[model samples]
Structures are given as C-alpha cells and as structure tokens.
Target: MILYDEIKTLSDKYEERLKSQIEKRVSEMDGDDLSHHILYQVLGVTSEEGHDIDVYQNKGRFLYKYAGSFLEEAAKLCIKSKFPDSATTRVDNTLGVRPKKFEIDMLVPDGNAIEIKWRDATTDGDHITKEHTRLRVIHAAGYKPVRVMFYYPNRTQAQKIQKVLQDLYNALDGYYYYGDSAWDFIREYTSVDLYKILEKIAEVKTGGK
Candidate 1:
C-alpha cells in the first residue's frame, strides 16, 4: 500500500510537470507555421532538404528525435537518481549472444526485464506483436520475472490500457505493470521506489535549468 501511494504521488507530480513543460513549449512555437501531422510527430521525422520539418539545436547538434529516446532517457535518469551507481546494472553497455534481435529497456540486478511504453492505448499494437515476442524470447532463454511497464499521463488512461491488456491477452497472466499493481509487483521484488524516482527525473528534466 505504501508503495502504491508513493507511485501515485510520483505519477501525479511527473505528469503535472510534463504538462506544464509541453504547454510552455507549444506557446513558444510558431503555431501558424505548425502543421497537423507535424504536431503529432513526437517520435521523430526524417531528415530531408525540402521536407519543411522543424529543426531544433542543442549542444551544437540537431535535436531531431524525441518520444522514445526522451522516455528512455527519463527512465535511465530515474534509475541513476535512485541507485547512483546503476550504470553497471544496465544491459545496454553489455552485449551477449542471442538467437534473435532483442533489447531490454532496463535490467534490474536480479535479472528482471523492464519495458517502458507511453502511447495511445487504443492504437498501440505493441502488446500483441513486439511485446509478446520479446516476452516469449526472454522466457525461452530462461529469463525470470519480466515486466512490461506502461506510463500514461494519468490514471484514466492507465486503467484503459490495463483493461485492454486484460481483454486481449490470455498469455499475459501476471506480466503487465501499471499504476498501483505495478508498484506492488516492483516493491515485492525490490525496495526501490521506482515511481518516486520517475517523478524526480521528470521534475529535473522539465523544470531544471
């Protein structure tokens, strides 16, 4: 229960900060020049000479990609913020032999897999396709206690996704993580307050100088 409360509080804080940051950025952008699809392209847009794409610069490099990297960075930052020396726990820096192409978003010291997703619950087809394949691979390879974490901006969206997963997947017996249920599963395995870490990471990235 404590973990769930902490998770809810952190989710609330991060979402509030993210919403404000997005509003601020939108206000600064030239709305008249923005197109409908352009507004929707949070992941990334291809680099073409005459594509009329919006280019942003940071640290002398073109900051073209968003969404996935942004979410991943935030997740990594949260882990670092909590573990400090979590660099070694991450599988990204290490490589090993595998039968097929696979990547773990975050790996705990106990060998648990964490997959993070933030998208439209109604349209995102990952649960049936990529996620199923990834879990099957991990299980076949003898990986224990894998987790799929879905990050929504609010409780309503999170619940909707939870229902969708429940309705669609018979294979997902106890692998999906969202909101309080996720917090419970995470706390059962580790004492780390993942939700609080997420909240802190969001605050630092969106509001920090």
Candidate 2:
C-alpha cells in the first residue's frame, strides 16, 4: 500500500489503543468534564456524533480531519503523562489568546506546538509554503513551533524527501526537523510510547500515565 494508506491504517489502529486508555482513566475520575468529553468525541472514540457534516471541500477537509485526529491523540498522551491522575488537567484548554482557527497536528502545553502536513505532487510546494508562513507567525509571536512534513509514496525526484524537509527547515528562522528529533518531540509531547504512538493512538486508548 501507499505511504498515506499505510499511515492511515496505522492511525486507525492507534486510535483504538488510545480509546481504551482514555476510558480507563475516566473510570477512575469522579466526574466527567466537558473538555474530556469533547476530546473523546473529537478523536472519534465516543459513540455520540454531533452535527455530522463536512466543513471544508475536497481534500482540504480530509487533511484537516486527519490532522485533528493526530493532534487529539498527542494532546491526550501529553496530559496523561504530565498530570496522570490529576483531576485538574486541561488537555484541550487553549493556552494563548489566539483563536483556534488553524488545525494544529499536535500541540503541547507551555507553548510547544506542532503542525503536521502531508504532501503529494499536486500541493507539496503549497503545503510547505503554508507551513513556513505559520512557523514564522508562531515564532514572531514568541511561541515554540515545530513543523512536521510526512511525505507519502516518496516520489519526488528533484531531491530526497529528507533533503527537501531540511531545506525548508534551513530557510526558516527557528524551525527545525532533524532526524529522529521530530519523532522524539512527538513522543514527548504526546505522552504516547514510541513503538506504537501513531498506530495505537489511531486504534484503542491504551493505559498511560
């Protein structure tokens, strides 16, 4: 299968694992919070489906949907890791005054953020440019942001995909995606273990701290 399909498949599996963990955590809690319910629903784990409809057209909507899924998993992991049994953990709470207009792939508390982008031939350059723009804005606003480019099928002939990513990082002032470092950040921020972070997050909610 193609890389996108592969990633999607893995994401699905990851979601299942995440769901289990979340359910277990909630079982231990005294009362349910709206933020927790919102997160659970957003990640597609909850049975309830509110206002099921499409907002964006074509692939744009699909991209946002997947990106949001990834971000929710990351946020859940981060909250569990940092707070564990703490009842005051606010995973979905916005830290800054900025409105939640953009779809951030993954985000961490204390201003650490990640924006994930997937590129095919049709919109690779556009995606890269947009990421750069967003990075600049975040940097200028004094927030630590990380850009993650997950290229599927690996068909770009101009240069290696890693090189392309490197060049993009080099062009940016404070953005970087060094080998394994990006994954490391993903792991740390998401609180999900490395081996099945993506896949498990897409599958069941495994027990986590």
Candidate 3:
C-alpha cells in the first residue's frame, strides 16, 4: 500500500512542476487568453446585454468542445504522473443508446472503475447543477464520478474565481470539488505534454523504496 505521506510528497513535487508549466503557457498567449476568455464568453456573461442567444450557443458549443480536448490533455497528464499503472485515460465514451450517451471530459481508471467529469472553471451554483446532472449519469452507469474544476488566477475586478467555485460546490447535493485547497494536487497531476505524468509515475514505481 502507498503511504499517505509518500503520496502527499509525490503529489506536492509534481504540482510545483505543473504550476510552472501552466504559468508559462498562460504567459505565452499572444491574443486574449483564448481558452479561458472564450469559455467565459461562451457561457454568455462577458458581452453586452441582449447578446444573441443562438450565436452565443453556437460559440459556446464550439468553445466547450474545444476545451474538452484540452481537458483530456490535462487528464492524461494527471493519470500518467500519479496512477500510471492503475490508470487509462480517454476523452469520451458511449456505453449504450439514448439516455446512456455520455461525453466524459476525461476518464481516469481508479482502482475499481473509471472517474469522469465535465471540466469547468467556476462551479457557481448554476454550473454545479449542470455538473451534478453529469455526475448522476456517470453514477448510474456504474462508474465513479469526479468533478475537476480548474483554478485560474484571480482577476483584479473579480475577487478570485475559486470562491465562486466553492460556493457552487457547497450548493451541490452530496458531492464536492476536491482541488481548491489541494491545488497542489492539480499542479502535480496535470501536464501540457501528454504521457509525461504516466512516465514519471512509472519511474517512481520502478525505483520504489
């Protein structure tokens, strides 16, 4: 069995490395921070009043789907670094027909089954409701549901997005987001380079104590 301290130590070290990488990528953006900015806009709050709902919906769909790809990349990093041997990462899967069609943002194999989610930045009450719906589907399908919320740097005008996420999670039924205080875990788990985390986990396992 993996000791708690060992897991914590490895998680911390990996998170530090992840923070540097994410910062670099954010800093390198030339135009607007397209991913986050687009996400907010697509959700329909960033523009002037009476923005066309149809246009917003189209843009939102495009942005959300694009972001799903990014989430998969991040998930792959997480699985590779922390649970390399025990995990297999996938973008989305369809198990059956009609109501059973679920698009997972990322799927990581935990001990007994797969953990899935729809990645989002803020889990504000409204957003959390939607997340909960997805979680319900996953639970019904005999898989573990994990909600992964991305923590971004606080904007000067917006008093940190993390608080909004917390409020959203608090309002949810029975489930909560796990990475706010444990952001160190996010840093350790995500990677810009796919498979890097898995390779690291393998190295650690190979050199085990």
Estimate every model's Cα lDDT from 0 to 1.
0.48, 0.48, 0.45
Q: Can you tell me which runs of candidate 1 are displaced by over 4 Å?
A: 1-100, 118-122, 125-127, 148-174, 194-209
- TM-scores, in order shown? 0.43, 0.40, 0.35
Which regions of candidate 3 fall more than 4 Å away from where they truly are?
1-72, 84-100, 111-129, 152-175, 178-182, 187-209
Whole-model lDDT, candidate 1? 0.48
Query: Whose TM-score is greatest here?
Result: 1
Over 1-209, each residue of candidate 1 has an lDDT whose tens digit, in order, gives 54444444555555566556555654555454544554345546533411334322221121112443454455444554455434422222112344246776665555455565543344455544554555556555444434445444345754665565544333533366655765554545455556565566566657744
Q: Lowest-lDDT window of 10 residues in candidate 2?
A: 50-59
By TM-score, is 2 or 3 better? 2
Q: 142-177, model 3: which lDDT tens digit per residue?
A: 566544444343454233344543454444332334
The lDDT leader among the candidates is 1
Tell me the number of clashing residue pairs for each predicted model. 0, 28, 7
**Runs in model 2 with CA error above 4 Å?**
1-80, 83-101, 117-123, 149-153, 157-165, 178-181, 188-191, 197-209
What is residue 133's positional error in candidate 3, in angstroms? 2.3
What ordering of candidates by TM-score runs from best to worst? 1, 2, 3
Q: Could you tell which candidate, 1 or 2, scores higher by lDDT?
A: 1
